[model samples]
Target: MIRGQCLITNKDDQYNDPDVAVILGSDKNPTCESQSVLMAPKIKLSSGYDMPILGFGTYNLNGYQCLTAIHSAVESGYRHFDTAFNHENERQIGEALRTQIQMGNVSRENIFLTTKLWNIHHDPRDVRRICEHQLNLLGFEYIDLYLMQFPVGYRHMCDEILTPINDISVLTTDVDYVDTWRAMEELVKLGLVRSIGLSNFNMEQIQRIIQCSSSKPVVNQIEIWPGFMQKDLVDYCRYNGIVVTAFAPLGQPNREKHTPIYFFSEGMKRLVKKYKRSAAQIVLRYLVDYGVIPIPKAGNPLHIKENLKIFDFKLEEIDIRALRGIKSKERLVQYENIKNHKFYPFERED
Candidate 1:
């Protein structure tokens, strides 16, 4: 096993970094200050911690690829990271951060790392143990944001704790999400985590957590894009002082195979030509204008830089409206297997 801060991976397997440094602002954009690099802007959470408006999402990234992506994100000036225990890459993410610190590329204090408690580990008695296990895997003292990945709680098998199985037959715990939230509140008091939040929860679930907990969830990470805006949920979270985070910010990458192309809507194309930015950047900026943080994942050097460039440009009010006009019923990341679970949150017809 890799010990301390050292990474255990083959040198030949390392991800390629082009070593090209783009200033925060290109000369063509006179409105941008050329002196500053294009790092993501931070927004203050209800918990009083500052979270970057854009973060690198480490979902489905693993092993050397995970390490490489993490390194590239840090090198590209990304300070916030979003990962989950269920993603199964916390060790690689942690190793990458430790490697970068060792190389003087970045420091721990400067990075905002987030991970979640898996549904199986939501048992109140096992919450601390789960958090400690994540800390050990991450090799960090405290996680910046710790979230309950889902409202569904399962009875974790002792033998399967180390190797989590994804079968529905595994019985669920007698625990409820509110009890889990109470236990999560204790995690904050213990100094193991800086902030606590929810993911994949609907309005009622979030409200329940808010009402029951001593420490409120500062942010809610959900699947949001132009098509499946979840406008009502977003508005509710805003009205309630909870920040909204968009996962799959660019829509599901492979969605084109099953759905019609919505990326290049006539309105989006117009904005792309007017602003000289990618369609992806325009959509991300759209969410940002609505006070939502988008965590778009990418490992390529150019793609990573392109995703960060959204902050340098502002979409006019007219353009924002035009882009928001595009509509469809495309909701990705639906956990249909657990829809019957008592805590499943997407049941509302609204």
Candidate 2:
């Protein structure tokens, strides 16, 4: 039997609960092989909502591919779905989610749905409109969590004018993130969302938001992987009562030139043999051990199942220490296009 302690955050920002523990075993584990991975525990957010420590990410996936992957993910026992308006796959995810709910696979209440407010709509007047547009696309009553996709605000109103790449035509907006955050806070008040959070924001930016907004950001979704540990920022978020969710946990294997699978070196081979798990699983377990939620995007059903199987085992603290020793601070998802924007995050370190 493997014993693991669940981390619960109280109002004071403490992440400990010695009184609560879970054992991974046959009787306690569900019979279905896929459902067995649902044993992954939930972490309570400051918003009083519990989110699964592991979430299925929907990025760079579109149309039928995204729909199929989401449907497969739910069948594989994933309860959390992470998407963004910028991802352009929300409609597909929404359709898949609705279909699953109708088919009795999972309910909206049980799934943690997250979407972001694109930077184009950062203007206070545009926030609600973009959010409502996403709502209509999602076909949902209320979003579980809404986040600002990036700190840099853009002035483009039409989708055709906005492009992911840097274009002189796409101008930066004068609207501040503080104003956007406050508008996001209104989302909670209007019952349009359960919680509001941040994504792609750095430490100083997060501090400014906290100081200026009425509602504290419940989470910060950033690029985190075995190679890019981001210890300082992760520490700051944890200490400040914000849950950190790691995207690109497997090092974006497809984008090897930009985000190489550095965790698959000779040093990791021993752990792979010891745990009998994939390199991706080991990397994910490392984040979970540090109380950081990891949202790994996997299109293959086997990979999805393997990713969720991390809960069945716990790494020794010594091993975790060694894993942390592998240091490379390369950020994979840095928006180089908007790096020069005044509100651009990652311009400074913690």
Worst 10 residues of 2 by lDDT: 1-10
The digit string of per-residue lDDT tens for model 2 on 47-70 reads: 989887889999898988899899
The TM-score of candidate 2 is: 0.87
Instruction: Give the count of colliding residue pairs in each prediction.
Output: 3, 0
Report clash pairs, candidate 2. Answer: none
Q: How high is the lDDT of residue 282 in model 1?
A: 84
Best candidate (score: lDDT): 2
TM values, all candidates: 0.85, 0.87
lDDT of 1: 0.78
Kindly report which residue stretches of model 1 are placed more than 4 angstroms away from their true locations once superposed. Answer: 1-36, 158-170, 255-260, 348-350
For every candidate structure, what is the RMSD over all alpha carbons to the true structure, in angstroms? Answer: 9.2, 5.5
